[model samples]
Target: MISQEQNEFLTQVGPGTPLGLLLRRYWFPVAAASDLNNTYTKKVRLLGEDLVLYRDKSGHLGLVQERCPHRGVSMVHGIPEQDGLRCQYHGWCFNSSGQCTEQPNEPEHSTFKDRIKIAAYKVQEMGGLIFGYMGPEPAPLLPRFDGFVVDNAIRVIGQAVLPVNWLQIMENSMDPVHTEWLHGHYHEYITTQNGSKQEVAFQRKHLKIEFDRFQYGIVKRRLLHGQTEDSDDWKVGHPVVFPYMLAVGSGGLGTYAFQMRVPIDDHHTWHVWYNAYVPGPDVEIPDNLKEVCVYEVPYKDQNGAFITDYIDGQDIMCWITQGAVADRTNEKLGTTDKGIILFRQMLKEQIAKVAKGEEPINVFRDPAANQFIELPLERKKHHFSEGFASITQRFQTKYCPVAQDLIALFERVGVH
Candidate 1:
């Protein structure tokens, strides 16, 4: 257990805080590219700061303070012009760099616009998502992970706003044994209660679990009841990519996905399930797949009860029940929680490194090395013997807009 001070040190993410400063060094997704299609502007909250994301007529992206400096009005209603965003209240225009450029009502000889500025950060778009960097100057390049840059692939984005801290959601990725209970036994019970005829496939007891500190973050391996050392699950397990993302899914001819846990603030988390379905070379990807499909995952019913039907929904139920910040001071951890303990230690070490004026893990710089960053994941999953139909019914993929079409795609490619 840790003290309250230690927990706060790791949890608090406001401006100038230790964790906040460290998080600012990396880029986080602020909005989906399609979110600004109709309105061309979005209000975003990250690390306890309110900001506005907009696209100008000249096809440039910008993230600036939500409030205008002239009259403190919201910039969400600002107009997107050829050069910058112009406030609707008074025609005050600010460029992408947060420099006020035009004040229509000001005197022709006035220099007030030159002296006015507001907070702004760099924004970039990749794979249908817009990411923002609020750190110091000389920002690092946005990482081009395999799922985002791969060719002949279909992608979809599913998001959920959880009323919990981002740290707990990340800690869930490290706990391997929870699958046996939370997603296995509890899953069986919930399905039975809901009057569903399907049986849970994750009932195997875990024999042993291990974690290793890799260059990216931590790679977790698990040995189940009937698995051996020769199994791919033990040889090349999946990884948690640095501070925020968990990379999961099967290898060769299967799906690859990333679970991005974006911190909205101290008490809220924007959880994104970014998935890519890459089939064999025998198949031809459809032309309509150029634009990614984005949807919101439902966690609660109309009656306000938690929805535990799918895998991600069940995980959300547990994370939200842990309270807003998860009181680690009164919690008890066991031997099976070795991975969680190791991850906490890693976080502290990285925090200390940043405190000493050094770069932490997963900050990319070299463009040559950043091209197509491939993560090593298990070629075979433990429950994959159940086949592709299992994935279509059990995961968030069930709600995908192209669910039936993808099933047909796998059939045509003979991947099942």
Candidate 2:
């Protein structure tokens, strides 16, 4: 167990806090690229700072401090012009770089407006998401993972705001033991109905889980009962990217997924799950595959019960109910909790690196290395299989509205 002070240092994310400083050093997804336009500006909050995001008439995107420097009015109501965003209040205008460009009412001789400015960060659009770099300048290039590199891959972006600290979500990515009971045995009991068969075969299986260091981050491996060293799961276990992303699952409908979590503040996390559907060699790609599908994955039902239909829904249910920020100080951790302990230690070490004026792990500056960086995955079994379509069908044994929406989509596009 940790002391209260340690817990505070780990959880608090406001300006000047240790964890906040570390978080600001990475690029965060604050809005969907399709949501911003010259006609509307999106309001977003990240790392406890409120900001206004918009696309100018000339097609340039900008993210700046929310409140106007002149009268402290929100910038969302501002008008998007070719040169800058004109504040709805008194026409105070600021450019994409956060420089004050104009004051309609100011005198010709006075340059007062030119001297004012608001906070602005660099923004880049990628894979249907607008990412903002809040770190020190000489901003790092966001690494291009396999999902972004594949040709004509369909990107379906689903977002959720979970009431919990970001670490809980990241730590969960490292824990594989929970999957045995949580998603298998325990899940069987909770989701069983109509005399449906339920079994603990997964839980009863002898399993060994291990963690190893990878170039980008940590890899968690799992081996079941009599499984050989050459088994796919044993070799290509999921890789958890440094700070806040987990590239999980392989083969079938899983086909590797990118789960990213961003700290909205101390008590909330902004989650964006990227599921890329890669087409098989024989499959013909559709024209509409290039377009992104955006949707919200709400956590609850009409009866106030957490939705447990999908694999992720069960994971999210546990994260939020653990209490916002989680009380680590009064908790007990065991041998199975080594992964969580390792994650915490890694965080503390990286936070110190930022304090020492050094670049932390996974912060890329070279464009050559950043362009189309492919993560090595054991996809032989996946691509060789008939296709991903049949795999997604097995999970839909139980009827769910959201699954129906997704399954129907699979039928239209021919899931790969």
Candidate 3:
């Protein structure tokens, strides 16, 4: 456990905070591209700063402070003009660059517009998501991760605003052992898609966990029984993209899902789960799968209790039960928590780097170095047999929809 002071230093994200400043250096999705229209503006809160995101009539994107500079009016009720948003309270207007352009309440000849401005930042759209950079000047280019750049892929954005600290969700991603219980023996099987379900016990079996640092982030490897040292499971694992995002499945639909755990503040997180489905080389893409859908998911069931339907729901339960900014000061961690330990260490190191004014691991400067970044997925593709036991593999497969799709993808891709 860490001291209260140390905990605050790592998790608090108000302006000028250590962790918040570190996070600001990288670009994160502020909203779904398809959700933003000329009709309305989206309110975004990140790193404890409230901001507004909108698309103008001209189809340009704008991200600026949520409150107007003049009288601190909320832009949520503002009007989207041809180039910027105008305050509905008065005729005062601000451009997409957050520069005050018009002050109608003032004298017709007044020059007050030149003396005031609102905070604005660089915003860009890629892979069906709108991303914003809130760091220092000359912002780095948003790296085009391979999962977001698949050709002819059907992009899916899974958005959820969890009432918990972003750190809890992030730490959970690094922990591969949780699958043994939360998604394994402790979980009740629901249904199956493939042929006759195979039943096998997975309790008390010896498993090995490994962590390897990648160019972008960490790759977590879980080795189950019957897997050898040179096996793919023991080799490559899923990529935990720096900051917060996980690439899951995509072998079949020709897409992979990117799990984005974006911090809305110290206690709230904008959990945007991105899924991309790409059809095979010669296979015809289905018309139904072509439609784009972006929506928020709830964590409750019809019964009103915390939804325990599938693995994802179960995972959410873990996060919520931990409380917002979990009392890491009172928790007991075991050997299975090595990944979390490594994650915390890296967090500290990266925070220190940002403190020294040096860029962290995944922050890219050169545009050339920022595109088409792909990690080793050969393990996730070929090591499918190692993720669970045969007896409960179907339920495991059903729980991890991404991996299920990719398992078929691996077979088609002809990856040994």
Candidate 4:
């Protein structure tokens, strides 16, 4: 168990905190591209800072402080101008760099606007998601992971804002043992209670689990019941990308995903499920597949109860029940908790590195090297043989807008 001080150091993500400083070194998704399709501006909170993310008339993206500098009016209702966001309250305009460019109510050619500025950060669009960097200047290039840049792939983005610390959600990614009990036995029990006749696929018992530190982040491998080390699950484990993402999915079936956890604050986390479905060589891609479909995955039902039927819902239930921020000091860890331990150690090491004013892992700078960085994954996942239909039912894909179209696409590609 860790000390209360250590837990606070790790869980706290407000600005100026050690862990927040470490987290700020990397980019995080503030809004999906589709979010701006309906409305140009979205009020977002990241690293405990209230912010407004907007798309100007010229199509440039900007993220600035949510409160207008002049009167503290929220920029969420700001007007999108050609070059910047104009506050609806006083006609004060700020550019993408947070520089006050215009104050229409002030004297013409006045230098008053020149000195006014608010917090603004650099934002970029990659794979239909808008990522913002909130750290120091000379920002690093966004690492183009394979799932985001793969050609001829259909993309879908699902998200949920959980009232739990980002660390718990990320720690869940490192814990392979949870899959056996949580998603396996617990899932079976839940389904049985719900009176569903569906078969639970993740019921397989794990024999062994291992963790390895890679250039980007941790690689977690698992040996399941009746499976040897030769299996792809053990041989080519998936990666948990440093700071934010867990890269997973079946490589053989051309289905890949990234579970990105963006810290909304010290008490809430924005969980993103980014899935890419690559059709077979001979399948004709549909025109609609060019755009990423975005949706919200519900973790709770209409009756104010946590929905634990699906895989993601179950995971969310556990994470949220751990309290707003888990009390790590009171926890008991075991041998099966090695992955969780390693992840904690990694976080501590990275936090120390940031404290020393050094760059942590996965901060890319070289453009050439950033182009299409591929992550290792198991070729044949447990659900590969079950086809795309069963796969959809197990995860958030069942809530996807184009779930039927996905099934049809896979069937045409002879995946079924």
Residue 248, candidate 3: Cα error in Å is 2.5
Candidate 2 lDDT over 64-95, as tens digits, reads 99999888999999999997799998998899
* Candidate 3 residue-wise lDDT, 269-326, digit = tens: 8887776655555554455445555755667868878765456677888999998888
Query: Can you tell me which runs of candidate 2 are displaced by over 4 Å?
Result: 193-206, 251-254, 380-387, 390-416
Residue 79, candidate 1: Cα error in Å is 0.5
Model 1: per-residue Cα lDDT over 1-416, one tens digit each: 88999999988888998999889989999998999888878999999999999999998999999999988999999999998899999999999999999999999989999999999999999988999999987999999999888776788898888899999999999999998887888888887887884556577899889999888899999888888988877888899998999998887557888999999999999999998888764467876665788988898999999888888889999899999999999989999999989988988888898899899999999999999999988878875656676776688778878777777888778777
The residue-level lDDT of candidate 3 at 355 comes to: 92
Give RMSD (Å) of candidate 2 vs. truth: 3.3
Report the C-alpha displacement of residue 273, candidate 1, in angstroms.
Answer: 0.5
Cα lDDT listed for each candidate: 0.88, 0.76, 0.74, 0.89
The numbered model that scores best in lDDT is 4
Better of 2 and 3 by TM-score: 2
TM-score of each: 0.97, 0.90, 0.88, 0.97
After superposition, candidate 1 runs with Cα above 4 Å error: none
What order do you get sorting by TM-score, best first? 1, 4, 2, 3
